[model samples]
Target: MPINCKKQTLPTIEKEQIDLLARLSNASGVSGDEAEVRKIIREEITPFADSVETDVMGNLIAQKNAKGKCALHVLIAAHMDEVGFMLVDKDSEGIYRFSLIGGIDERSLAGKQVLIGKDHLPGVIGACPVHLSTKEERECILKLESLRIDAGPGCTDLQLGSYAVFATRFQAFGPSLIGKALDNRLGVATLIELLKHCPEHIHLTAAFTVQEEIGARGAAAVAYNHKPDLAFILDSTPAMDQPSYDNAENTQYRTRLGFGPAIYAMDSNTLYDHRMVEFLKTTATENGIPYQIRQPGGGGTDAGAVHLSQDGIPTATISVPGRYAHTAVMIARKSDWENTLRLLTASLDSVSQDIFKNER
Candidate 1:
C-alpha cells in the first residue's frame, strides 16, 4: 500500500551548506588522520544535537533523541576520511618517499601537487620528465617506488608519518562542484544538513566516521557502539558516465552526474537490506524526488560494516554520483546533491516501525 501523508517540506540547499562542503572538501583528513575534519563537524553539530560523543576510534557520534518513548532508532553515517599519502622515508633535503593511505590510483600520482603535514606545506609528486625518459621507460607504468614528493630544497619540517592530500582547491564550475575529497565530504556535508533538519519522530544518530578510505574501521566500531535499529550510509559513488573511446552506448557507466541520488541494491560487500532499499525507493517515488538505482557491482560503503554488526542491523546506501573519485579532483552536480538531501529528508520523515514489519 502507498503511504498517504502530508507533503514533506524538504530542506533547501543554501550557501551555508555549499560553504561547509567546500571547507570539508578542502580539509586534509586522509584515512587515519581525520582530526581536522572531525573538529569541524564537532563544532557544526554541537548546538543542534541532543548529545555528542567522540568514541575511542575517533568516530563522532551525535544523537537527537525522539520526544516520545520507544521511537525507532535510525543511524546515518558519512565517512570523514579521504584517500591520500603518508610520508615514510626522507631521501633528501626535501624529497620524501611516501606510501598511499588509501586506494588512490598510482597512475594519477605523478606530477600532482600535494599538501603535507598539519601546516599543509606544498609539495609535488615528482617523476622523471618525459624529455629525460627513454621510450622503453615511458612505456611502462609508473610505480610508487619511482615517485618522490619534492617539498622544496630548504624544507626539513616534514615528519616520518605526516599525512598529505591533493592540493585541489574547491570550486564551483557552472552547476557542478569540483574539489578533492568530495567522495565522502559531500556525504559529510549532507549528513550535517540532515542533522540540522532531523525530524523529531525518530531517534537520529548521525555518525561522522573516520578511516573509511583504508577500510570500514571506524564504521565497524561505530556500529558496535551505537547499534541503531537500521542504518543509512551516505557516500559519493564514481560516475563512469564519460563517453567511451568508440562511443558504443557506454553501458557500464555505474552512475551518472545530474541523475540525482544513486540508491544501492547490491555491491562488493553487503547485499543491501531489501526492506530499507524498498523504503528508500518508495519514499523517493512518492515524494517525486529524482533517483537512480546504482548499477549493482564493485565498491562498498560504510553499510558494508554496519550491517554485519550486532545480531543484524538493516542497512542501505545512498550516494551522489561523482566523476573521478579518489583522484586529485572529483565533480558532482549541485542539483543532484540537493535532490539527495531531499530524498533523505523525506525518507526520514516517513520511516517508522512498520518498515520492519515487512519480511526481509
Candidate 2:
C-alpha cells in the first residue's frame, strides 16, 4: 500500500539543525577543500543513516532501508561546498595572491576576514584604499587581482598552497540567520534534520555532495549511479530583497524571508518535473505549509545535474531563501527552514501513484 500524502506524519525541524548549520557555516569548505566539513557530516549521519559511504569525488552518500519497493528511489541532494578563495601566488614580501573558488562579487572582496590552512590561520583581504584611488581608478571595476590577503606580521610562515574560507561566523539575526556558507550549509543541515525522523520503509538516499560551487560535478555522478525515480535538491536560492537590486524586474523570482521554502519551477540547469512541481506546491497548499514557486526563468540547483543523468530522472528543488549569497554574511529565514523540513517529509510520506500520475 502506498503512503497517502494526507495521512503522512509531518516531521518538525529542531534546534539541533540550527546548531549544525552554524557549525558547518563556521567550518572551512572552499570547493575542493571540504575534508573537514565531510568529517563533520560523517559523524552526524553515521548513526541514524542505514549505510554511510563516500563517492569517488568525496560526496557523502547515506542510504536508508526501503522495504524493497521498486520505483521507490528518492534521492535528496545538497552540496557541501561553499564559495571562498584559493591561493594563486605569493609576493617576495609574502603577501598572498588568491582567486575565488566560487562566484563572488568583486565589490564585497575589500577588507573581508578569511581562514587559511589546517591551523585555521586568520587573514584579511585588503583592497586599495578609496582615498588613494584616482577618479578613473575608482570608476574602474574591482578586478580579482586587485585583492590581496594579509596573514599579519609573520607573512613568510604561511605557504602559497593554503586555502582561504570566509571567516564570518554564524549569528542569529532577528527571525533570520546571518553567517557564512549558509548557501549550501543550510541545505546540508536540512538533510541532516530529515535523517532523524526518516521512516525505515521510505527507501531514500541522501547525499552531501561536493564541488557544487565549481560545477554540479558531485551530484552528476551520484545521480547516474542511483538513477532514482525521483530526485530533489535541497539548496539555498539567493534573495533579491535588498536595496541594490530590483526584486521584480532583473530578478526572475522573489521569495521573502520567513516565507516557507522556495520551490523552483525552472533554473539554468533543469526544467523541473511538472508533476513533481505541481504535487509539491499543491501538497503544501493543502497541508497549509507555506511555499512559493520560482518564476519562469530563474537560478538553478543540484537537481539540474540529477535530472539529466543516465535515462533522465524526474526532479525538483526546494530552497531556503538567503540574502547576500556567496558573500561572508548570508541570511536565511527561520520559517523557511521549518517549512522545508515539513515539505520534504510530507512529500516522502505521500507516495501514491495517483499523486504521481501524469494524467491527474
Candidate 3:
C-alpha cells in the first residue's frame, strides 16, 4: 500500500493572523496588571504607529497618520485585560486563596488549572470531591469561598496580591480556535492589524486599553484624552449557541459560529450611535459580508466608557463571538474572526467625512 498524504490549503487568514492571536490570548493580563499583554502590543505597533503613549492608567494610545486627507478622526479601541484571580492569601500547607479580578463564574472554576504571577507558577483550583460532599452540597454550584489554589506543597515563588490567570494554551483546529481570554485578545490582535493597515480616510487613534475588566476605566481615560469625532470598540462577545440543557431548540442562541460579526445596537451601557449602527450594517451588506444584530440586552464594551467621554462621542461596537467567555477556556470560530476583520477594515476604509454629519 502507498503512503498517503493530502495537500491542504488553509484559510486566507492563516498562520500570521493566528500566530498574533495565539501570543495575545496566551499572555496573562488580568485587569490591573496588564503589563505583559501591553508589552506585546507595544512592540507590535512600534513600526506602524506614528506616536504611541502609555497613559497614566496604562492605556496604550497610539496614533497612525492617514496616508491622505483625514475624512474622520475615528477612535478605535480594544481592551487588553482579561478576567482572572488575584492572590489574596497563602494557606498553611502552601496552597493559596485568591479573589477573582473580574467577572468569572465560580461554579465552573473548580479543578481548572491556573498560572500565578510573573513566574507563571502552575496551580490548580481545587474543590471538594463528590465522595466527600452530601447530596445537598452536590446540588449546588461551587462558590469562591470554598476554593483554594494549590501550587503544590513546597512552592514559594508567589506572594500575596499577585495576579493569576488560566493556563489555557491557544490552539487552532480545523475552523475552531480555543484559548483563554479570547474575549479581548481577539480584539487586541484585530486592533493591531487595523493599525498596521491604517485607513487613509481616517485619522486612526487606537487605544489598547487596560482595566476594561474592571468597569472600562482605561477606556474612560482614553475617550477623554483622544476626543475623536467618532469611535468603534472592538471586543469579543459570548456566543451562547450551545445546546440548551433541556435539549429543545436553543432559541436564545444570541450568536452562533459562522454567522459573522455581531453588531451592537444596544447593550447594558450606552446605546450605540444610531447612524454609526446604520453605517456598519450597510457596509457589511454592501460588501456581501454576513453580520448579526446582537440582541439588545445586558453586557457592554469599552464603548460604554468612551461614549461618555468628553461631553459625548458617536460610537459603534463590534465583537467576534466566543463561547464560555470569562472562563478558563473559550471557543471562537476562525471564520467569525476573519469576517470581523473584513467588516472592520472595510468600514474604516470607507468611513466618510459626513459619517457623523447626520443627526443623532
Candidate 4:
C-alpha cells in the first residue's frame, strides 16, 4: 500500500530561532535548578499552549488539545537541565569546594571560568600550578579535592549549596553554534519551535523536563502524569565524529555534523519502539529531509524513563549530534538543528493510530 504524503513545506530556521537557542544556551540551569530555563520556555510558549502547568517535580508540561474526537495523544519532551557544580563548603573568604551535579568531566575543570548562583558571581576553578607540581603529580589525573572555586577575596555574597556553571557565552561560528549546555538547550529550542507551529489533528503535550543530566527524574514524573498514547524524546547526542588518533577510518563515529538528525534505535536504558523509529524514518524520507541513524550503544535520554511508564508507552528519541557534551562548551551545526526541527514537524503533522496497529 502506498502511503499518501501531504508533504507540507518545511519551515526555515531564521534568526529569531537562533536567538532563542542562544538565550537558552547562555542561561545557567544546572540539574535540579532549572528555574531560569523553565521561565524562558514558559513565557515563550504560554500564548501558544492550550494550557500550561509545572509539575511538583519541576517538569513544565504544556498541552495543546486537538479539535476532533479520538485524536491520538502525542508527547514530545526536551530536558531543560545541564551538568554543573554545587558549592558544598567554604574554604576561605572567597574560596569554595564544590561537588559535581551530574556527569561533568573533571579533566575539563582546571582554571575554567565559572558563574555561581543566580547572581552569576564570577569565579575560577583553581588548580595546583604546573610549574610547582612534581613530575609524578603532574602525571596523575586532577581530582576534585585538588580544585577550588576562587571568586576573589572581596566576594562576600557567596553561599554554600549554590549552583555553578561554566561562564561560556553562546557563539555562532561560520556554520556552527558553540556554547555551554547545548546538549539539551538545542532540544529545548527545537521543542519551543514545534509548540509555536503545532499541527491541529493530534493532541500535543510538550514536556520541558528537568534533572535529566542527573537521572531522568522529571521525565518519569511527566510520563506518569500525562501518559500520552506515544512519545518522542528530543535531545542532543554526543558526536564522536572527530578524526581517530591512528589516522584510521572513524567507523565508530556515532554521528557526524551536517549529516542531519540522528534517530535512535537502542541505547543503555531503552530499546526504542520500532514502529516509532520506522515512522520517523519514513516521514523524513517522504519529506526529503536528511537524517542519520544514531549508532546503537550506551548512554540514554529521557526515553529511558518515558518508555517504561504505566504498562509501557511507545517512545523514540531523535537528537542533534553535538561535540564535547557535558563539558564547558559544545559545538553543533545549524543545518543539523534545522533538519531535526523539520523531521519532527513532519512527523507530528502525520502521526496517527496506524502507528500502533503495526506489530512491535
Candidate 5:
C-alpha cells in the first residue's frame, strides 16, 4: 500500500490568526500593566503599520499612509487591556487577596485559574468544594472576599503585592471560542488583521488603548492628541443568548454566537453618530459582509471616549458578540471575528465626508 498525504490549502484566515489572538488574550496585561501585550502588538503590527508610537499613557498608536494628504484624519480605537485584580494584601501564611481592577462578575470567578506577577505564576481561585458546602452556602451569593488565589508555598514564592489575572484558556465548543481577555484582546487582533489588509488610500490612526476597563484613560488621551475627524471603536459586546429570569426584553438582545459582528448604536455612556452607524451597516450589507444590529445595548467601548475628545469626533462602534464576557470563559465566534475584519476594512477603504460630518 502506498503512503498517502494530501496537499491542503489552509484557510485565508488560517489557524495562525486564532493562535495569535489566543496567545495575546492569554498573556497577562491587566489595565495599567500592559507591557507584555504592548510588546506583542508592537512586534506584529509595526511591520505592516506606517508609523507607530507610544503616548504618555502607554497607548499604542499605529498609522498607515493614505493617498489623500489633505490633513483629514480618521482615528480607529480598540482597547487592549482586560479586567483583572490587583494584589490587595498577602497574609503571613502566603494567602493572597486582591481587589478587582475592573468590573469582574464574582460569580464567574469562583473557581477559575489565574496568573500572578511578571513570570506569570500559575494559581487558582479557591472555592469550597460542593461536598464541603452546605445547602444554604451553595444558594448564597459568592463574595470576592471569600476568594483566594492558591499560588502554593505562599510564604516563599508569593508576595503581598503580586497581581493576579485570569488564566488565558481558549477553547472551541460547538460554535463558540471561549477564553479569557476576549473583551479587548479580540479588538486588538481585529486591528492587526485590518493593518495587514488596509489599503494605501485610507489615512487613519489606530490606537490600541489601555486602562479601558478601569476608565477610558488611554482613549481620551490619544483622541485629544490626534483630534480625528472620524473614529471607529472595535470591541467585544455581550451576547445575551442564555435563559434567564428577565425574558420579556431579553429576546431583543439576542446577539448570538457565530451570527456575525455587531453594529453598536448606543450604550450607557455614548450614542453613536447616525451616519457612521448607517454607513457601516450599508457598506457591510452591500459588501455581503455578515453583521447584526445590537439590540438592547448595555456595554461601553472606546467609542465613549473617542467621541467626546478634542472638538468632538464623530464615532461609532463595531463589536464581536461574545458570551460570558468579563469572565475566564468569554466565548466569541470565528465568524464574528471574520465579519468584523471585513466590515472594518471596507469602512476604512471607502470612508466618506458624510461619515465625519454626522454629529449625532
Candidate 6:
C-alpha cells in the first residue's frame, strides 16, 4: 500500500514535540564536541530503531527496515552540532579568550551570557563600560578582537580549549518558538518525529550528524557508509525574514515566517536533484500543504556533503524557516515545522524507484 495523504492523518505537533525541542535547544553540542546532545538522542531513539550504530566521526546512525520488500533505501539527516566558541586561553584574572567554532556575527558577542566547558559553567562576554568608551568605539560594531568571556572573579575550574555556548534556554512565546541551537535542533526534533512513524515502502536510515557547522564533516561520512538510493537533508535554514530598515521593502528575505517549509532547488553548495524537487512540490500541492522555494545563493546545509558522497546520491533539502540562526537565540513557527514534517512524510511514503528514473 503506497502512503498517501488521503487515508493517513498528518501528525500534529504539540506539547511533546515542544518538550523534546526544549531538551534539544538547551543541550550543548558544539562542533567537535557533541557528547551532550548525542546522549539525549540515543536515549530518545534507541527503542524505535531496528539497529543503531555510532561511528568514529561521532554521527549516530539508526535504521528501520520496511514492513515488506523495500523498493528504495531512503536516507534522512539532521545535524546535531550548533555554532559556539572554544576557549583558547585563560587570563590571570580568569577571563577566557575564545575563537568561534562557526560563522557568527561579532556584533552579538558583547554582554551575552555563555556556558563554558563540559561542566556548563556560567560566563559572560564583557564589554567596555559605556561611560568609558569613546564615541569612535561606540559608533562601530564590536569585533572579536575586543571581546573576552569573564567566567567571574578568581574562577579557575574551566580549562583552556573547552567549548562555550549561549546560555539561552528554550521558550515558546505566542506564535513563535525561541531558543538557542534552533538552526538544526529544530531539524533534530523534526527527524525524531519522523523516525517514530517510519513509512512502509522505503527502508529508512536516519543520520543524526555532528560538525555540520564546521563543514558537514559527519554527513559526508554517513552518506558514504549508507549510500542510500536517495537522501533528504533536513535542516533549519535562516529566514532573514525581518522587515527592512525604516519599513522599506525587503526583497531578499531568503524565506519568511508562516510560509511552511523551504524546499531547495539550488543552494550555494549543490543543485538539488531536479526530480526529487518536483516530487516534493507535487506532494505538497496534492496535500494542500504550504511550502516555499528557498532563494538560491549563499549558505548551505548537510546536502552540500551528502549529495556528493560517492558517484553521487540524488539529494534535496527541506528546511524550516528560522530567524537569527547562528546567534544566541532563534525563532521559528510551530506551524511551519508541522507542514515541513507533513510534506516530507507524505513524499517519503509515496516514494518509489520511478522518481529516480527521470533526468538528473
**Candidate 4's error at 358, in angstroms?**
1.8
Task: Report the number of the highest-lDDT candidate.
Answer: 4
Q: What's each prediction's TM-score?
A: 0.97, 0.92, 0.94, 0.97, 0.91, 0.97
**Cα-based RMSD of the predictions, in order?**
2.3, 2.7, 6.1, 2.3, 6.0, 1.5
User: After superposition, which runs of candidate 2 have C-alpha atoms over 4 Å from their true positions?
Assistant: 1-9, 68-71, 243-253, 352-354
List per-prediction Cα lDDT, in the order shown.
Answer: 0.91, 0.82, 0.87, 0.93, 0.80, 0.90
Residues 98-206, candidate 4, lDDT per residue (tens digit)? 9999897789999899999998889999888778999999889899987999999999988899999999999989999999999999999999999888888888999
lDDT (tens digit, per residue) of candidate 1 on 66-162? 8789989999999999999999999999999999988988999998999998889999998887899899998898999999999999997788999
Give the poorly placed runs of model 4, Cα more than 4 Å off: 1-8
Give one digit per residue, the lDDT tens place, for model 3 in 1-360: 001211121123679989999999999999999999999999999998899989999999899776666456889999999999998987767688889888888886898899989878899988887899999988888878779999888887678898999999999988899999998999999888888877565688999999998899999989998888889999999889888788999888777888999999899997988899999998888777789988788899999998988989989999998899998889999989988887887787677757668777
- The TM-score that candidate 4 achieves is 0.97
Over 65-116, each residue of candidate 6 has an lDDT whose tens digit, in order, gives 8878756899999999999999897776778788999999999888899998
Ranking 2 against 3 by lDDT, winner: 3
Candidate 5 global TM-score: 0.91
Q: Of 3 and 5, which scores higher on lDDT? A: 3
Clashing pairs in 3: none
lDDT for 28 in candidate 4 is: 90
lDDT of each residue in 151-172, candidate 2, tens digit only: 8767667877788887898887
* Residue-wise C-alpha lDDT for candidate 5, range 252-320, written one tens digit per residue: 554877778888777877887778889998888777777888874566878888888888888888889
Top-down TM-score ranking: 4, 1, 6, 3, 2, 5
Considering summed lDDT, which 10 consecutive residues are worst modelled in model 4?
1-10
Global CA lDDT of candidate 3, please?
0.87
The residue-level lDDT of candidate 4 at 283 comes to 91
Error of 6 at 77 (Å): 0.5
Where's the lowest-lDDT run of ten residues in candidate 1?
Answer: 1-10
Evaluated at residue 44, the lDDT of candidate 1 is 98
Work out how many backbone clashes candidate 4 has.
0
